[model samples]
Target: IRLRPGYFPFVEPGFELDIHCLICGGKGCSVCKYSGWVELLPCGLVHPNVLRYGNIDPDKWSGFAFGLGLNRLVMMRYGINDIRHFLSGDVRFLYQF
Candidate 1:
């Protein structure tokens, strides 16, 4: 896992969560796009404006958020190549689980 600076609209300070490529074991590979990292999610502190919109006071509260890409997670976890297999309305693939 690696933590680096990032940015997102909804958060004041943002971050990206990338895991060491399971396929490459931290080595550069096609699966990791030769960067050796698989981007999985994004996180950050809640923006004050966003918090205000939710009826929360920025001065009184602070928090962080993470956006998980389920598709990516599934692909990484199962080593899936074609995203269609997961999004396809076909039940055949679901049966594998």
Candidate 2:
């Protein structure tokens, strides 16, 4: 796993979490875009503006947030190369789960 700097609207010092590609075992593959890594989530400290908008004192109540790519995680878990398979509405694909 690795964390890289990233940008997101609701967070300050945002980061993107990535893990070594499971499908190809870090040898590189189309699913990982040949990078040997697949992004799994975005995370960071909550932006002060967001806290202020929520009527929370940012100075006193700092927090963190993250959004997980559940579909992506599942894809990696099952070695599904294409994400469209999950949304295709095909009984063939649905039956496997």
Candidate 3:
């Protein structure tokens, strides 16, 4: 995914977009805290002026991003009942899978 930086009244360099999480195929998951994503950082190329505004050169910088949520999906798929159960290593549940 690609994102562009723009000015927002509240933020110095506002990010208008972010990448989708690979896990759950962006559908959402328990591991992602039901957010369907693991990473929650806003990503984008810093605006040239914004770069200068922060005393950094925009001409020399670029960025890329991706995210995942493995555990949440595992809980959702296996009918784990509770997230803590997975950690307990319960024999009954392990046998079912």
Candidate 4:
């Protein structure tokens, strides 16, 4: 995993997490879109202002956040070629999991 700069109103310092494309094995592939890396999540340290708004004291409290891309994760895990397989409501696809 690696961190890249990002922007989020609720966070002081934000980042995006990227992992080498598992499907491509670091090579260009449809799953990787030829980038050789996959963006799996956005994350960040909690902003002081956001802490205060949540009734927490910024002076002592701190936090971090991460957002996962579920669809991407699934594709990597199962080597799924088409994302629509997840939403197709087909028993054959759903039953695989």
- Candidate of highest TM-score: 2
For lDDT, the strongest prediction is 2
Candidate 2: lDDT over CA atoms?
A: 0.92
Angstrom error of the Cα, residue 65, model 4: value is 1.2
Which ten-residue region of model 2 has the weakest summed lDDT? 70-79
TM-score (all chains, Cα) for each model: 0.75, 0.85, 0.31, 0.72
Evaluate all candidate structures by whole-model CA lDDT and list the values in order.
Answer: 0.82, 0.92, 0.52, 0.86
Q: List the residue pairs that clash in candidate 3.
A: 30-72, 31-72
**Model 3 per-residue lDDT at 8:** 45
Candidates sorted by TM-score, best first:
2, 1, 4, 3
Enumerate residue pairs that collide in model 4.
none
lDDT of 2 at 63: 92
Distance from true location, Cα of 43 in model 4, Å: 1.7
Name the TM-score of candidate 2: 0.85
Candidate 2 structure quality by residue, lDDT tens digits, 1-79: 9999999999999999999989988889988999999989999999999999999999899999998988888988988
- The TM-score that candidate 3 achieves is 0.31
